[model samples]
Structures are given as C-alpha cells and as structure tokens.
Target: MRGFRRGLHRRSLYHRSLHLPPSPDAAHAQLLALHESGDANAAARFLREKTAAGSIFPGFLSSVVIDRACKSGDLRGALLILATMLHSGTPPPNQHAFASLIDALSKSTRLADAARALELMRDAGIHPDVVTFTVMIRGFCKNRMMERAWEIFQEMIKSNRCQPDCFLYGVLIDGYCKELRMDRALELLREMRVERRIQPDVVIYNSIVDGLCRSNRFLEAWKFLDETMVLQGCSPTVVTYTSLIRGACKAKKMKLAVRIWNAMLERKIQPTIVSYSVIIDGLSKAGRVYDAYRVVREMETLGCELNVVIYTTLIDGLCKSGFLDDAYALYRIMKRSGAFPNQRTYATLIDTFCRNDRTETALGLFDHIRDYCPLDVAMYTAVVSGLCRERRLDDARALFREMRLAGVSADTHAYNVLLHGAFRSERPEEAFRILEELGDDPGCVANLLTYNTVIAGCCLESGMVLFYEMRQRGIAPDFATYSALIDRLLGSGEIGRAFDLCEEMLASGLSPPSGVLGRVVARLCWSRRGDLAAKVIEMAMAVDDTASFSLPWDDEDGAAQDEDSQGEELGSIKDGATQEEPVP
Candidate 1:
C-alpha cells in the first residue's frame, strides 16, 4: 500500500512538471485578485490571451470575469465577454452569468440594453429564471416605468418557468405603494393572502404601512398594523415605527410622534441611526430643539454613538432659531467627537453669519473649509447671496468669477441673486449686463424666477418684451411672473394693460398678489376710473371670496373716503358697456 501511494504521488508530481493548467478555483482567484486591485481589464486580457492560445476557461470562471466587468460599470466590456463565451463554447455560460449583466444594465437605467441582454440569453439557449425577471422588474420600478414592470411580471408568470415568489410580490407591492397607487398595492396583498396563500411578511407590511402614513392616512395605517400585522403574527419592526413617527412629524403632531417612539421602545425595537436622525430633524423643525437635544443625550446614554448627520440637524435647528453661538459651540463639539462637519454644516454657519451682517466671519469660515470639503454650488450661492444682501456687489462679483474659475457653474438662482442685488443697489446697467450674460450662456436656461427678477428690475416696455421672450422660449408664466408684470404696468398708469394681464393670470389658475391687487385698485381710484376700480375688486373677490382689499385713497379733506359710489358707478358701466369694452 505504501509503495502504491508513493507511486501515485510521483505520477502527480510528474504531471505538474508538464505545465498543466491550474484548477478552476485557482484561476478564478487570480481573476478576482486582479479585479479587487482595480485591474479588471488586465484580467480580461489575460483570459482572452490564454483562451486564444488554446487554453480552456471554465464557464464559472468566465462568469466571474463578466460579473467583475459589470460591477466596474463596464457593461459593454462584460457583454463582449459574453459574446466571446457564446462563440468559443469551451464551457457554456449559465443563467447567473447573464443575470449579472442584466442586473448591472438595469441599475444603470439602460433598460433597453437590459432587455436586449435577456433576448441574448434566450438566443444562447438559456431561459431566464425567477432571479432574472425579478431584477428586470425592479429596474423598471426604479425608473418609474410601472407598466413595463407589470409586463415583465406577467411574462414571468405566463411562461410558467417559475412561480412568483414572496420576494417578487413584495417588489411589485412596494413599487405600487411608492407610486401612490395604494389600491393596486392592496389588491396584490389580497391576492397573495387569498389566492396564493402566501402569508404577508414583515417587509410587505412595512411597505403598506409606510405608504398609508405618507398618504396621511394614519388611522388606516394603525388599523392595518393592529388588525392585519399583529393578528397575522407579523411583528412591527423599527422601520414601521419610524415611518409612523415621520408621518406624525410631517403632519405637525409631535405628541403622536412621541407616542410612536415610545411604542417602538416598548417593543424592544432599538432605533437605528436613521430613525434617530429623523426624529431629531422633525423636532428641530417644529421648534422643539430642546426636545431634540434631550433625545441626543438619550442616544449617547444608550451607548449609541451619534453620527455627523445628527449633529448637523441639531446645529441647523440652533442656527435657524437665532442661537448662532450655541450652533457654533455644537460644531466644536462635533469636531472634538471625531465627527467632522459636512458641507451642509459649514454652509449653515456661513449663511447664518452673513445674515447677521458678519460677512468677515462668514468669509473666514468659508476660506478655512474650502480645501477641506469640496465646495458645492449651494455654498457658493449662499455666500454670493450674502454678499449681495450686504450691498457688496463688487466683492460678490469677484466671488462669482472665482466660483466660475473653480468650475462650479452658476445656476439660475445664483444669477437671480446677483441681478436682484444690482437692482436694489440702483445699478440698472449692471443688471442688464447680467441679463445679457444669462442669455448668452447656452448652459443657463432662464427659468420663471429669472424672468420675474429681470421684470422687477426693468421698466414697463422692457419688462413686457422680456415676458414675450419668456413665452417664446416655452416657459409658461407662473404667479410671481404675472405679479411682477402687473405691478410694473399698474405703477406706470397702464390700467387697461394691467387689467388684461390680471385676467390672463386668473386664466392660468394663479391669483395675483394681494398687495399688487390693492395697489392696482388704489391707482385706478386715484385716476378717477372708480368704475374700473370697483370691477377689479369684484373680480378679485370672485376669484377668492374671502379676499380683502385695502384702499389707501383719501379725499381732499385728508380723511379716508368710502368707495360705495364707485360700486354704484361700476354697476352702471356693467349694464351699458359695449361688448368690445369688456370688464377686464
């Protein structure tokens, strides 16, 4: 027996000396190592060169290569590998290999390519299984293409290749809930329970509960939790409670939010960092910062380390509540606790200081953090807007140029800020130059706010021209746009044109600003168009029955005068006016 064993070992060594290929597991490990080191292309090249030299790579190894390429976001490269596998046919690829490619393509929003990959899979004599169809359906749902997702779901069932599992039903239900199609979601739940006889899991219950809460049907959510979830032996998780808490906070029912929080604790469902963050943010926004702080303290006491998000939430609450000193102190604490402030934390501090007229401090903080965190558009816009508010247009313009040089493109909001600042500083020429620059930039499409700001700065004719230009650009005028134009026309004593604009504004389902309407009525009464003024008031009241108009007109006696006579005259005009001279 010993001699036989010795002979077998000697034969194995001799076979190794012939330079025989390594095992498939060893080859796969080499490819995975290459992928881990971020040299997936090198692995692919090695596989190709070896295969070209008559070396055979097993199907599983080939699948690993494809998976690596897809994970690296090189879907095209992965598909090429799949094509090579198809033609080479050393060992045929399996369902998992194509599934990897399909999943990656779906995640990248390349749904068309993903569908083609499925066709390729079929052409390669491989039918898609449950996992493949599930991935495709999820991709469609993520892209908000619900109809396509349903088609894929139906295809999976119609093919009878695999039955719809619990996970598949959960994905479709979640999708419907997210789209606010609660009716369809519940229908699926009913089918799962009655026809399929699949007991709804915790995940399915969570989706339904979250959907109901988001739709502000809190009572229904609670009823489902009590009747369906609890009765069906499905226990509520932290996510369910957190969803309820979020809904309560959004609806400004903090007392109910606290009750939900307590219920979660009573059930021994430990709050996650996300749950804690949501409650903290809600409390802060509700002006209950002290309560938020108490929760933070409780978290620390429970040995749950607070993250940067929690600290930032608290700091924002402090800043907005006019406790800048406290906010900065918290910032120091955050840094000391080994939690660095993110861009939002820095932006809040800088904006608060600037609002308090401490431009130098805000600038200093901005400069200190410029190299630490990547400065985003919001931070730059905040400082630019702050400088503009301080009437330091030159400094603001310099920073704007610096922002451009830094490759942070200025959006419409940034331009609007500078334009408004110029107008406020009585720099019409500079404002017009900004407008021209906006028109010249191909990347900067003017939005409604942009036109509104310019109209607010320009005179009546220029503003009217800009309005027409806005329409030509396919940008519909919003309420603010009409408000600015109507205010400008009424201020220039163009009552007829102002009334025409107001009528258009009403037709667009937007009410003019009450202040602007009051001004128009006062101007009409002052110009002895009392009949037109009364008609304007009537139209305003028609649009909103509870609308109130304050007339600031006075007689020569220096006392406020009643406009009852104006209403009487308005009635007479309405009775005798020609069709050409309409109420507007």
Candidate 2:
C-alpha cells in the first residue's frame, strides 16, 4: 500500500481540473520552487486559489503544501490549508498533517490555537497520537506554563489514549529544570525511572545536570554524574561536560572547569566546537587570554575547523584584556582564514578602540560594517559613548541622529550615555534637551539614571530643583542620586545642605561613597567649620561604625591622636572662639 501511494504521488493525478491546465506534478513543482525562492506568500496564494477553485488535490500533495507552509514559518497559512482540506473532505487530514500544524503553532507560542487545532483533529475522527501530545507538552513547557503542561501530562496518562513515554517525561523535566524547579524535575525523573520503569536517556540526564549547574547546585550535579549516571548506565555526552564547564566558568571556578575538560578527554569523548568555545570564552573572560589562545591553537592542531564564534570570543577577550593590537591581529587572521567577523566581533573591537582614545579608528570600523551588518543598539551605544568620552559632542550628536535614521531606536542606556556625556562636557543645555526629548517620546520614559545624570551636571540650586521634580514624578532617589546631589552641594560650599543630604542618605539606608564623605569632611575642616565637621563625622560613625572618616588633621598615633585633636577643636569652638582661621 505504501508503494502504491508512492507511485500515485510520483505520477501526476490530474492535469486540468481548474482554469489553469497544469498537471498536479507541474503545480507541485511550481509550489516547491516558490517556497525555495523564499516567496512563501506566492506559494500560499497559489495553494489557496487552487483549493478554492474546486481543484482536487491529492492527499500527499495537500500534506506537502501544509508541511512547506509550516517549514516556511507561515503557521496561519498552514492552518488555513488544513481547515480547507477538512472542509472539503476530499482528502481527509491525517495525523501527520495535523501534527505539522500543531507543532508549528505550539512553537510559535500560540498554544491556545494549537489546542483548538487538536480538538478539530479529534472531531474529524482522527485521534491525536503521542507525537501530537508531545508537541503540545513541549510548547507549554517552553512557554513556562508548567501547570498547563502538567495537566496535559496527566490527561495523557489518565485517558489511556497513549501511554506516557520517556520523551514526554524528558520534556516536563527539562521545563522544570529551566524554571529552576529542580526538586520537581528530580521527582519526575524518579517517577519515570522507578515507577514507570523508563530508563532515562542521556538527554534527560543532561537536562537535569545542566539545571543543577545553572542553579549553582554543582556539587549535586557532580555527584549525580559520577554516581547516579554510572549506576544507571547512562554515559555522559560532550554536552554534559560542556554544561559543567560553562557552569564552572560562571561560578569563576576555572580550575574545576579545566579538570572537567581533562576528564572529558580521558573518557575519549571528542570535544565539539561548542565545548572548545565555552572553555575559550570562560578563560578569556577570566583574564586568561593567553590560555584561550593556546586552546585555539590546540583545536587547530586537532584538525578542528575554527569558526567565527570562537574567533569572536578570543577577539572580545583580547579587547577586554587591553590587547587591542593582538585582538586586531587575530581579527585579520580570522578574515584571512575565510571566517568573517560578526557584529559582536566588530562591536568589541570598536568599543576597545574607543576606550583607548581611538574614536576615529572605531568610527572607521563602524562605517565599514554599517553597510554589511545590521548595527545593533550596543554597537551604536559604544560609538556614541566613545565619542562622548572624547568630548566630540557634535560628532556624537551626529551619530545619535544616524542611529535613529537607521531605524534602530535608542534605548534608555543609549540616552543615558548621551546625557552623561553632555553633562560631563559641561553642556547643560544639551542635557536638558535630552530630557525634553525623553519626555516627548512616550516609549522613552526617563529612568533614575537620567535624573541622576542631569543632577550630577547641575549646580546646587538647579540640582535641588531637579531632585524635587524627580520626587514629584514619584521616582525615588537611589544611592547615585543622593551621592550626586550631596557631592555637588559640598563642592559648591553648601555645607549645611550637604549634611542634610547625608541625613537623607542615612535614612534611606544607603552609605555615601567613602571617598566623597572623606572629601566633604576635609572641606568642612578647611573652612574652619571644625565643630560641624566633627559632628558630621560622629553622626556618620554612629550610623555606620564601619565608616572611615578622613580628617584634615593627621597624627602619628592614628585613632588616639585624631580623637584628641577633634576634642580640642570642638572645645575651642565651645570656648567662645565663634570663628576659627581657615586652613591656608
């Protein structure tokens, strides 16, 4: 029967049923061509018109069209075709047809629609098989709707329509693991193993192991792999070791990661490119660029083809470690090796160049990649920040406009960068303009950083006004906000106001920056407000005994000598010396 069906599919069933006189073979060929050419719309339109015109499509042909639509990411169109097939009743929709549609819809996050399609399949007297239910379960788990997924699993078991399998258990376990619900995931794993007698596969073990690592339960992960996995006869794959390496890197346990890498090699499991990439990235981020390069060389020696991602990781690591020339040299090597640098590679190099006072070089790189690569906000932010750091406000402004013109809207970070630069460059007017621009756009709500940046730029009076305005907008002042205001007040000689701000800072349970506090105390003492300075120091120490106060008067005996000097200064003010001479 299968051979007969294949023969029928091979031969054109009909040639001239509709206005168009093309055979089914010719129509199918045209549809496939359209799909391959990336014109899914034309393909869908052609299918819909043929179906609407009473053209009889073979069951195989309908399934082909449906599969193509789903593969093209046209879930809506695929569902429509399925609906048309069911309505026509010429070629009844099979499990494969419904499964394709259900899988696509579920993956697309239209879970409810996928459920509806499942009901339609059942109503048409086609019972959904295990694959159908698995797809739905995976979709729900992926969407983080664990409750719904559990209900589906329960229904599958209770209804006896299809026995729950290891794959189903694996899906739910992975979902729980991803949500950091390791306990539930383990519970399910136990139930699958002991109760259902389903041996957990490597995939399930990998999921739980990865979950343990990600949740920082590395000890348990290690124990499970060493003891439980060995007893259960499940061998750890490269993915399992890679997960361990990644988790170790995240926890900054590079020594442990290296040990795991060695163990993987001892087991004779060849490391995949991803495993190499993980180690390289981890080492590079840990300031071990030379070690990362050695791994790259080792990978090449083992005859592993170097890809763009590995090169990009090394480039970024070198850039971060302040080896711009080395990073650029590798980049040139990568290009010569026929591996193109991606946006991240370009962004990393550009950011590094800008940081090292090489804005022009950064700009040149940006211009070179602008036409080829779609510039993301991070790339634009890097250039704008670098230009701002260079105090090239005009050039920064031009680039900001260019970013918008490129259809990439500036995020809050981008705006914050510009606002901070404007304030740092003493362009108060430009900072205010940015605030106004943020206000005009509903999407760009001013965050605390925006307010803090403006306050950091303003004088005492202007800053105070902005602070009150920030409060009126119900934006609470954070540590940065309070610090900025207090620092400005102290610099402007508003000693009393600075103290009041300190009181607010204490009330909010935020300790002022130690350096700023020290400077304020020194300034007060220099201005002959020695009594007030002592009081402020005592207040800060009372609030936080760990607070270190730097006094203008230094003594060799440290605490004892400083205390004696403070007492003498306080007594001098109390003894009718209403004013003391300012320190020259």
- State residue 516's C-alpha deviation in candidate 1, in Å: 3.3
Q: Clash number for every model?
A: 0, 0
Error of 2 at 253 (Å): 1.8
Best by TM-score: 1
Q: What is the lDDT of residue 229 in candidate 2?
A: 81
> Over the full model, what C-alpha lDDT does candidate 1 score relative to the true structure?
0.79
Candidate 1: pairs in clash: none
Clashes of 1: 0
Where is model 1 poorest over a 10-residue stretch in terms of lDDT? 565-574
